[model samples]
Each structure stands twice: as C-alpha cells, then as structure tokens.
Target: MSRLRSLGVPAALFAAVVAVALLATLGPSAVERLAVTGLVNLILVIGLYVFVGNSGVWSFGHMSFALVGGYVAGLLALPTRLKGQLLPDAPALVRELTAPPFVAVLVGGSVAAVVAVAVAVPLARISGLSAGLATVSLLIACSVVAAQWQSVTRGQKGLSSIPTSTTLWTALGWVLVALVLAWGYQRSSFGVRLRASKSDEVAAAAAGISVPVQRGIAFVLSAFLTGVGGALFALQLGSINPDVFYLDATFLIITMLVLGGAGSLTGAVTGGVVVSVLAEVLRRVEGGSLFGMDVPARPGLADVVLGVVLVVMLLCRPSGLTGGRELRLTRRGTGRGDPTREPSGRLTPVGAAGGPGEDRS
Candidate 1:
C-alpha cells in the first residue's frame, strides 16, 4: 500500500502528460516531430536524474554514454551494404552484422552500462568538484576517440542510413519506462541510503552504508538509461556524429536537470517538458516570426533566454519549480500530531505515559 501510494501520483501525472503528447501527434507532421523530440528529451532528462538526483553528483560525461549507444545502435541497424561502403576498415564483426531495431537498442544500452561500470570504479572514490572534473575529462577523452576512430565511427564524417524505427508512440513509451524506473529507484532503500550519503558522507559511512558501492550502482543504471535514450535519438534522426553528443547536448541535459529540481523525479519531468517547449518557441522566434508576423531573427537569442531563465531560477528558487517535492494528490503528514489541531490546544508527545490532564502516579 505504501509503495502504491508513493508511485501513484507520479504515474498519474506521467500518464496525463503522455496523453496530451499523443493528442498533439494527431496534428501536422511538424507538430508530431516536435512532440517526438520533447518525449526523447524527457527520457534523456530522466536518465540523468537517476544518478545525479540520487547521488547528488554532477557528471558531464554521461553524453558519452549516449554517444556509445548511438554508434552501437547505428552499426547494428545500418544496412550491410551501407556499412561496407562507409566503414570499409571496420571490425569484421561489425561490418558483417545486422540487427533488428529493438535488439540494437538493447545491445546499445548494455554496452553503455558496461562502459559506465568501468568508468564508475575510479569515479566512485571521488566526489564534489573533483568528480565533476573527472567526468568532463571522460567526455573529452570519448570525444577524441570518436573523432579519431575513422574505421568504426567514420571519424568526423558521421554515421548515416540508420533505420528510423522510433515513432512518437515509441518515444513516449520509453519516456514512461524511464520515469517509472527513476521514480521506483528513488523510493527504494538503495535510494534512501544513497541520498543519506549524499547529504553527509561521514554520517552515512558511520551508519554502515557503502557510499562508493551505492554511487557506482546509480552511475551504471544512469548510463544504461541514457544509452537507451541515445539509441532512440539515433533512430529518431536516422543519423549521428561524434559532435552530436558533445558539449551542446551535455549542457542542454544538465540544464533540464538543474532547472527542474535535480532532487526529485517530478522536477526532471517538469524541467524537460518546460525547457523543450521553451526551446521550440525560441527556435521559432529565431526564425523571425510569431503567428506569421514578420520579425527580425536574432541569432543566439534562444540561448540567451535560456541562460537568463536558468540564472533567475537559481537565484529565486534553487530547489526548482516543484521545490524538491513530488506532486501528490492527498495530504499525509509524517505520523506526527494532527496538523489541523489548534495552536492553543495542549500538545502531547507520542509514547507519553499519560494524557496532559491525567497525571501518572
């Protein structure tokens, strides 16, 4: 019952949002495309939330996981003829192989998880600013490798002709899956202990919780989900390049997490939706029009707006729009006194031997 109650509100909110997106898909193709992009962003943000939210660690390298997943999925899903033409010197296994879209996605996520484990071992020992810098280094290393590896990733030329199998509905389905996984993990005992460690490392260690192990677990899980999002991203576009997963994407995803309240699942979802919509509007504005009116295009205007919004949000409400609280329909106290009680009324502590007026002999 308790678990159900915990999951219910978020589930309902997710369903409502998905339903609206589905309806939007019934409109023109542009609208459908925008909706699909928003859904994909939602998955990516949720993936970031899984580790960053629970462990309170900032990772600039997660986009590398997405890059890995995208490449893996692209290699598996691209036609053999195309692969031979584009990647003649590729590994014999990759050059000859082909896989269904679903299998490709799974394999991509699995490989990303493996890489994450390898990365997390060293990362788990560090925290705060140093850990963040380590992740940035990882991102740089991955970018260099991707750019120099001509045989597999085609170097800077990018990979194309990947099968487009991700529809709007498919993207939405993945978003829901990511959301449930993130929400469930946050409510689990592992999540509780991890959060404790996040709050105070010494106290958590004293309580017998292995901080490194918990953080590693979160890191791996987050990598897997982010990889899945990457696979979907490749399929959605039917193409990818090493640069696609670099700094711009990293900043965009981190912005979503920070803007939405990095501590809660609801915040991640809200941030993704709000940012994505705002970005789309800004993009249109950059095109020099509002409802078909002639307006001058201001290059970089969207980014400026986004930056200002982020600064204001940080200064005004550091906790995010939700204020670090989940959206719940019911009002339930923490098993303390009745909140509705009058202030002048006598207050009795729990486990008391007798009521206030009844003295114990």
Candidate 2:
C-alpha cells in the first residue's frame, strides 16, 4: 500500500499528460503544435526539478545541458548529405555519421549527462549564490561557443534540416520516463539524503551525508533529462540555434518549476500546465484584441505577464500552487505543523524523532 501510494503522484501526472494530448488531437494544427511544445517544456521543468527541487540549489545553467543535447542529437540525426552542406568544414567523423532519430535522442541525453559529470565535481563544492552564478557563467560560455563554432553549430544561423521526428506520443513517452525517474529518485535513499541536505546542509553533513556527492549526482541526472528535453525540442522544431538554449529558455523553465512548487513532483506538473495554458491564452490576447484591451503587441507581453505572475506568486504564496506538497486524495494536511504531519514531511532531522520514514542509518 505504501508503494502504491507513492505511485499516486506519477500516475496522476501521467494521466494528466495523456488528457492534454487527447485534447491536442481535437484542436487545430497550431494548437496541436503548441501542445507538443508544452510537453517539451514540462520535461525541461521536471529535469530542473530533479536538482533544484531536491538539492535546494538554483542552477541557472541547466539549459546549457539541453543546448548541448539538442545540438548533438540534431547533428547525429541530420542526414549525412544535409550535414555536408550545413557543415562543410566538419570533421570526417561528424560529416559521415548519422543515426535514427530515436537513437540520436538517446545519444543526445547521454552526451549531456557526460557534460554534467565533467562539471559536477567542482560545482558540487559550491552552494547558494555562488553555485547559481557559476551556472549562469556556464550558460554564457556555452552560448558563445555555439554561436562562434560555425564549422559545427553553423554559427549564428543555427542548425537546421534535421527530421522532425518527435510526435506528440514520442514526447509523451519521454515525459513519462522523466516523471518515473524524478519520482523514483525522490523516494530513493539518494534523494532522501539530498533532501536532508537541502533542509540543512550542515546537519546533513554531520549525519554523514556527503552533501557534495549528493548534489553532484542530482546535477548529472538532471542534466541528462534536460539534455533529452533539448533534443526533443530540436526534433520537434526541425531546427535550433544557440539562442534557443540560453537565458530565455532558462527563465521560462525555472518559472515553471517555481510556479508549480519546486519542492515536489506534483508542483512541477502544475506549474508546467498552468504556464503553458496561460502563455497560449496571453499569446492570442496579444495578437487579437490586446492593445485596446490594455495590452501591448508581440512577445514581451507574455514575459511581462509571467514576470508579474512570478512577483505575485512570490509575494502572495512563495511556496507555489502546491505549497511544495504532493497530492493527497485520501487525506488532507491539518496545517498544524505538528509531529503528525504527512509522511513526506518527515525527512528533516528536526522531525526525525517520531516521523514516518525517518533515516535511522
């Protein structure tokens, strides 16, 4: 029963994604396209959540991994004939290699995970403001590389001509995979220790939890997922530029996590759906009866509304829509903040004395 209860979170989330996909089929092509985009973004948000949610560390550079995955996957999936034209100066190996779309996506995620591992050791040692800033720097560095490496990335013109291989079902399949991984990690001993550290790093360390090690694991895992999201983004669009994976993508994804409640999987799903729908509505409003309706034209409107929403969320309810709590169909929190709290709230050392799932080791 306990194991089944834990599955409630992913089951509910999976069903919700399926419902959304079904609705997408009934809409116009544009709406269907938007649905796919939303699914991709949700995957990205979940990827970030794996690290930021559990580690309690904000990583602004997580999208860099996505950028890496997208490009690598795109390159691999591109027909060798197309590559010869798009990347005339490419190495013999890169120029000659091509793979099936699914294979390309897998490779994309693997490479992204490798990049994360490369940086995890040093990044693991930093925390708080420094870690966040370090990630931002990583983003900038990667964007610069992508823009200037004309021989491979095609410079500022972007990479294109890859097959559009990611259908709605393809993306949904990846979403389920990400959901399972995120939830499984959350329930694992690794995730427990990581959350323990997030609640209080000093105390977690004192309890023999290697804070850096846990952070590094989460970082690499999150990057792999993020990378896959990027690859899907690339496949869905059939093209990509360095700019696609930089700050703008970063902000939107982080907002999804924040709006949903970064501390829980349920929150991640909520934020992703809410933002996707809100953006779609706001988009129509901007293009339709907007300026006269006290709205400006073009893309800035969505950003402004998102910014306002973020501020409002922070001011009015900093913990997000779910308050960092998972869904509960069979019970409700009394809001008493007592020792008899929900089983999920018992990971902290302060609550360990008599709480459920307390770490006795």
Candidate 3:
C-alpha cells in the first residue's frame, strides 16, 4: 500500500495533465499532431531521465539509439515493395524482412539495448564532463554512420512509407508504461544504488555498491526506452531521417530534462509538456500578425524562443520546475533532508535502515 501511494499519486496527476491536453487539442488536426508529438517527446525525455536523472550524468548519445531503433522499425515495417523501391541495395536480410509494427518496435528496442551494452562498458568507467564529451563523440560517430550508410537508412533522403501505427492513444499508452516503469525503477534497489553513486561515488563504492554495474544497467534500460521512443516516432510520422535524431533533437531532449528537474519523474513529464506547448505556440505565432498587429513570419523564431526560455529557466530555477522532488498528495514529515537527494540521501546498505525496503513516508 505504501508503494502504491508512492507511485500512484504522481502517475495519476501526470495522467490528468495529459488528459487535459488531449481534450484541449482534440478538434484541430494540427493541434492533435502537436499533442501526439508532445507525448512522443515525453517518452524520449523520460527515457533520458532514467539515466541522466538517476546517475547525474549527461548523455548526448541516447538519440543515437533512437535513430537506430527508428530506422530498424521503419525499415522492417515498411512494405516489401516499398523497401525494394526505396532501398534496392539494402542488405538481403533487411530487404526481405517484414513484420507487424509492434514486433518491429520490439526488435528495434532490443537491438538498441544491445548497442547500449557495448557502449556502456567503456562509458561506465568515466564520469563528469569527460563522460559527457565521450557520449557526444558517440552521437557524432552514429550520425556519421547513419548518414553514410545509404543502403540501410536511405542516406540523407531518409526512410519513408513506414506504417503509421502510433496514434495518440498508442503514444499515450506507451507514455503511461514509461512513466510507471521509470517511477518503479527510481524506487528500486538498482536505482537507489545508482543514485547513491551519483550523490557520492566514493562513499557508495565503499558501501559495496558497484557503481559501474549500476550505471551500465541504467544505460541499457535507458537505451531501450529511447529506442522505443524512436520506433514510435517513425510510426507516428511514417518516415524518418538521420537528421531527425541529431543535435537539435538532442538539445531539445536535454532542455526538457533539465528544465523539469532531471532528478524526478514528475519533472520529466512537466518539462516535456511545457516545452512542447511553448514550441507549438511559438510556431503558430512565428507567422502572421497576433492581436491584429502585423508581424512578419520568422523561420527560426521558435528555436530562438526555446533558447530564451531555457536560459531563463536556468537562471531562475536551476533545480528545474520541480526542484528535483517527486510530487505527493499527503504531506507527511519523512525526516528526510534534501528530498531531492539521490538515493534518498541515505548511506545505509540495501537492506538496512532507510534502505530500499524502508517506508519512505
């Protein structure tokens, strides 16, 4: 019951927010697209949160996993005729493949997880800014490979004619799943250990936590979620390009994560929604007059506005909108210092007082 209280309240609140968004945007097709896309972004941002939020590490490379998953699912789900027409020189296995959208998405996510394991081995040993830079290098390498590999990804032109299987309901379903998984994981032993390392690496190691292994687990899980997001993106658009998962997307995802309090699931959802809504509003206003005032269209105005918002958020609320804390309905004094502290700020071993099994409330 305590566990349910811990996870259910926040999940319910987040769902309410999503429900309101859906209702507000239901009539207009463009608005509906924005809502769906926002949900997709929510998934991606939460996927990012699983690692960056828990481990206090930045990753510029998760989008690479997204790209891989998108392409893998898109390629497999495309009609065989379309594949042959667009990717005539694709590998025989790829060209001959066909699957339902769900299966393709699963395969894509699994492949991304495998790649993540390979990447995590080396990354688990590094930390701080050096680790971030190493991940950025990985992103760049993946981008180069994606762009240069014409046969599989269709090169710069991108892969199109994918099945459109990611409706708003579909995206929402996955978002809920991601939310529950993220919340549950954050309260789990692995998540606690990983966050402990984030809070104090040497202390956590001294307490018998294998920091590298915990980090690797988070990385792999994060990659899987990101891959799922990528597959959903392709399903939603019926097309994808390597560029779609590049630097701009990276910045947007990071901004959402950072702007919401990278340490909390509530923050991830809030940040994704806020950024998505703001961007859509800006895009709509970038062209034509507002309030009967003549305003010329600005091609890049939305980006500029987003940058400004991010800067303002950083200056005003460095811990993000949620201050890195989960939302709870009941106000009980838990006697916990720094509610946002990773691993509940407890130094106890896994089964000891204030450990994973202890009642947080």
The top-ranked prediction according to lDDT is 2
Q: Which residue runs does candidate 3 get wrong by more than 4 Å?
A: 288-295, 331-361
Tens-digit lDDT track for model 3 on 206-233? 9999999999999998998899999999
Model 3, position 67, has a per-residue lDDT of 91
Each prediction's RMSD to truth: 6.9, 4.3, 4.5
Candidate 1 lDDT, 69-184, residue by residue in tens: 99999999999999999999999999999999988988998899999999899998899899999999988998888899999998898898888998987887787788788776
Error of 3 at 119 (Å): 0.4
Q: List lDDT for all candidates, in order.
A: 0.81, 0.85, 0.82
Q: Cα lDDT of model 1 overall? A: 0.81
How many residue pairs collide in each prediction? 0, 0, 0
The Cα error of candidate 2 at residue 118, in Å, is 0.8
| lDDT pick, better of 1 and 3 | 3
Worst 10 residues of 3 by lDDT: 343-352
The residue-level lDDT of candidate 2 at 259 comes to 92
Q: Name the regions of candidate 2 deviating beyond 4 angstroms.
A: 289-299, 329-361
Once fitted onto the true fold, the runs of candidate 1 whose alpha carbons sit more than 4 angstroms away are: 331-361
TM values, all candidates: 0.90, 0.90, 0.90
